[model samples]
Target: MYQYTPFDRQFVHARAAQFRDQLERNLAGTLGDDEFRALRLQNGWYIQRHAPMLRVAVPYGELNSAQLRAMADIARKHDRGYTHFTTRQNVQYNWIPLPQAADVMDKLAAVDMHGIQTSGNCIRNITSDALAGVAADEAIDPRPYCEIMRQWSTLHPEFAHLPRKFKIAVSGATEDRAATGWHDIGLVLRKNEAGEIGFQVRVGGGMGRTPIIGSVISEFVPWQQILVFIEAVVRVYNRYGRRDNAYKARIKILVKAEGQKFFDAVAVEFKNILERDLDGSAHLITQAEFDRVNACFVRPAGVVAQPEVAAAADLPLAYRRWLERNVHAHQVAGYRAVTLSVKRAGQAPGDVTDAQMDQAADLADVYSCGELRVTHDQNLLLPWVKAADLPALYEAAKAAGYATPNIGLLTDMIACPGGDFCALANARSIPVAAEITERFDDLDEVFDLGDIDLHISGCINSCGHHHSGHIGVLGVDKDGTEWYQLTLAGSDGSNHAPTAVTGKVIGPSFAASEVVDAIEAILDVYRAERTAGEKFIDAVKRLGLEPFKAAANARRTATARHSDTAEA
Candidate 1:
């Protein structure tokens, strides 16, 4: 984890103080609500459906025990007793009062955390693979580069207000765990034949009312010029991206409309930045600055390679299952990355209670070198777990209800806080997610069914990343009733599906009561149609959506007939 420097701490504190002044004036009838709207949004405060929501940035998903504890305290004292971890590697509080917003900011700053640039049509948090540094397949650690971009984008005068919200993700591993293809700007670090480090730049990928996979703009951009190249990309978007309509303001829209023309414009801008501007080369990352940032990402003091040990054949079946699902390989021998399952029965996916946060912090201190990482899949990861401590850690995690062995199973779905908390939600997402989770509570059945990415969103904003799910459920409003639209064959560009693409909608939306049954019917079709060992997504692609669509719609038809019979 990158340690905060003196300047970093000072800047965070100053920003908190500035927000405090603005908040006080707003409450005192001096600054109007309209005037304070942008100010509050810039600082990560939103007047949500019920109360003020604060989105605290967790840059690249890195966190220390101290920061985790601070957040736990805020969840306990200030608002609800839990926090929601988002797919973008950020945390949100849905019940914080507007007046106490400044106080919350102060507490966050005390631990080197804040909501800066977390909201409001600007460059959002710079996210990367949760297993960036430790993944066995990594080509280069991306944390240092992510931190560099974080510093550059925060409060950037040139990009404070773009046509719409923008996001960027980076992945250095051979596998795209960060879902780079779904970001406004996706960066994949690689080394050329000359062993020179550079990035594969993909721009214009996003999910919303319009979901598009990013196009590869540059095959290889030298690492030193990443900032300058990105500047050119955003500069072009800011100049031409749609501002008249909020729905079409994302760079994805511009990229989709212009296609090759958009890429050409960006290339021209990159050349202009490097050659036409007086300080063209000023933004180039110097060796010294890179070294300074890179040094902070080194292995923690006490963590080192240990003698490899074999797993005991006598281990409990449940424990073995947990190990297989939740533990991941690390680059360092004898070390593994362990995921704490926040998605389980009876809870919304990614919702962590205050007590659980504290427990997680304690686990970090004891088992993971006091460090943690938030994964893009809406789970917490102990990135430095010793292989020797697996048993003890598993036991502790089980006791805390975080040891469910369903990491990639259907039960481990991603869902946003829909109508329950979000004002923009067309329907409630929690109930749908809860129903699906309850229907798939049997681990044996889940494991047999194999890995599935089930994502649910309250609306088209795609906050829950429904567009990337193998089985996607999106909430839609039909007249005044809540309904769900199902899609199949979507992917997040992981090993499961090497290409990132939005799921294709099956057919008409189903009533809320029929969603769970519809999902069950669709899975039933998959089971009957799939070949031996075929994953759900592969089956969907091979068999097409027609079979599953027919099954789901049949369930809807049956339900409607049953209702008619009852009315008769």
Candidate 2:
């Protein structure tokens, strides 16, 4: 994890104080609600359905034990005794009051965290692969670049109020766990045949009412000029992006409207900007700066890998299941990245209690070099877990309610805090997620179902990244009744061409009560048609939607008949 510099500390503290002052002015009647609303939102405060929600940034999904403890404290003291992690790798406190919000910001600053740039129409938190440094198949660790982008975009004056919110993501791993293809700007660390490091820059990707896979704007931009290319891209979008309508404000929509002209425009701007660097303004990046950031992320000393032990053979079946599901391969030998599942039965996905948070921090300190990472799938990761310590850590995690042996199975789902918390939501997402999780409670059956990414969003906003899931479920309202629409073959940016696939709608919407049944029907088709090693996404892609559609509609018809007979 990157340690906060003295200047970084000062910057965060000053920003907190500034917000506190604005809060006071608003309470004093000097600032009206209309003006204060924007200011508060810029500071990551949202007026939710029940109360104000404050989102705190977990930069690049990295957290130290001290920071995690601070977050737990915030969850306990100011709001509810739990927090909700989002798809952007940030956490939200849902029950915060308006007056206590600034105090919350100040408390966060105490632990070197803040809410700035987590919301509002500006560049948001820069997400990277949770296994950035640990993953074995990565071209380079992307945390340094993510940190650089964070420093560059945080409270950038020119970009404070864009037409709409913008998001950027970077992934170094071959597997696109970071879902970079669904971001406004997606950077994949790539090395060319000449062995030169650079970025494969993709632009105009997003999901909402309109889902788009980012187009590769630049084949390769050298490491030194990466920032220059980003600046050019954002400048072009800011200058020509639609501001008249919020619906068409996203860069994806602008790119769609302009077609190839958009790419050409960006190319021309990039060339002109680089060509006119008389004072070398465009070349802000340097080898020295890269080295400085890289140094902050180097592995700690006195932590060499140990030889494998035979004691693993004596572990119980439950412990073994957890080990196989949650523990991931690492770049270093004899070490693994352990994902602490927050999606236990009866609990909403991604919701972590304060006590669980404290326990996670303790486990990180005891077994993971005191560092943790947050995954985009809304789970906590201890990125430096020693292989030999797995048994003991598993026990501690189980006692703390973090050891749920369903990492990538049907029960391990991603969901947004929907009508339960958000004013923008059309229906409740948590209850649906809970129902689906309960339906798939049998671990053996879930494991038999195989790797599935089930995602749920309350509305078309796609905050749950419903478009990126292998089984995407979007909550919709039809004539005041809550319904869910299903889509198949959605991806988390792991396709062959470095792009994402927006899952196609499967069939007609189903009632909220029938969501689980609908999913079961779809899964039934999958289980019947899939080959030995076919993943859910691969099976769906190969078999098409007709078979699944037939199964789902058949179930719907049966349910309708049962209802009519009961009425008679």
Candidate 3:
């Protein structure tokens, strides 16, 4: 994690005090609600349908045990007993009062956390692969670059406010864990034929009302030129990105309006401006700076696994499953990336209690090199756990409600904190995620479902990444009643698939627990008909949505089946 420099420290502290003054004035009636709304939003406070939601930035989703403990303290002291993890790797407290908002900022600053750029149209959190340094497939640690952008983008004068919110993601591995394809600017670090690490810049990719996979504008942006190139991209968006209608105001719209050929020409012209005028060339991260950032994430030592833990890892069945799913190799030898599964069958997808937070912190102290990462998939990651200690670590995790043993299976779901907490949500996503978990309690059955990525969003912000799931469920309202819309063969990363709306389930709004069974039922049909060794999405892609859709819609009551709620 990047420690705050004196400048950084003063920046957040001063911002906190400024917000405090703004909040005081608003309370004193010197500032109106509209005035305070912008101020609070820029400071990352949102007036939700119920309470003021506080979004705390967990940059690149990297947090030390101490920071994790601090968040647990905040959750326990100020708000609810738990916190909601978001898609961009942020944590939110849904019930933060406006008056206490500044106070909360003070508390966060004490622990080196803040909400400074968490909201607003400014370049939001710069996310990277949660498995960055530890992933076996990575060519470089993307966090250093993420931090570089974080420092450059936070409260950037050029991008303080945009036509719409802009997001950027970076990936360091062959696997696109960071969802590079769906960001305003996606940077992938790659080694050129000359073995020099550079970036493959993807632009115009985003998910919203208009979803498109970003096209690569530059195949080889030399390391020294990354910042300049990035500025070029942002500047072009700023100059030409739509501002006419808020709904169609994202960069994706601009990209669509301007074809890739035009975007390329414009980006080229913009890059020349960055090279000639802006001297970001000097600020490019040097080797020494990279080493400094890398030094703090030192590999840990020591591991003694329980006999049964070793046995489990050695089991031909269990070991192979664990290796394929649980173990991701690290850049450091003798260490492995361990994804701690909190997304269990029958559990809320990303909900963690404060006690569980402490337990995770403890695990990080023991086996994980004193670090914890919140993955975009709504799970916690102990990035560098030793292979030998994985069994014992797994056991500790099992006891602490951290071990679920389902990573890519049916239960490993990503859902947004929906209507329950968010004013933008059309329905409740937590209960929907929870219901599905409850119905699919059998680990064996979940595995049997085999590599299905099911995502649900209460509404279309796509926070749950429902837009990118192998199977996505979107909730929509028909009249006053809430109904769910289904999308199939959609994927977030890896040969990315655009979200597909399969069919509308006709029936009374199913209980949250029942949705899982409904999904299981849909998968059962796929398994029965799928060809050998086929993953869920491949099968769905091989065979269209007809059969699965038939079975899924069958559970709909006769009245619900024919109702006008069906959107497709």
Could you estimate the TM-score for every candidate? Answer: 0.99, 0.98, 0.90
Off by over 4 Å in 3: 274-324, 344-347, 495-518, 557-568
The stretch of ten residues in a row with the least summed lDDT in candidate 3 is: 497-506
Q: What TM-score would candidate 1 get against the native? A: 0.99
List all candidate RMSDs to the true structure.
Answer: 1.1, 1.5, 4.3
Candidate 2, residues 436-509: lDDT per residue as tens digits?
87778788899888789889999999998898888889999999889999998888875322348898898889
- How far residue 47's Cα lies from its native spot in candidate 3, in Å, is 0.6
Please give the CA lDDT of all the candidate structures. 0.93, 0.88, 0.77
Q: Write down the TM-score for model 3.
A: 0.90
- Which lDDT tens digits does candidate 1 get at residues 217-293? 99999999999999999999999999999999999999999999999999998887788657544488889999999
RMSD of 3: 4.3
Clashes in model 3: which pairs?
Answer: 346-437, 435-512, 435-513, 436-516, 469-490, 487-500
Please tell me which predicted candidate would have the highest lDDT against the true structure. Answer: 1
lDDT of 2 at 329: 85
lDDT, residue 155, model 3: 81
lDDT of 3 by residue, 426-477 (tens): 8888777777777777767777777877888888777877777877777776
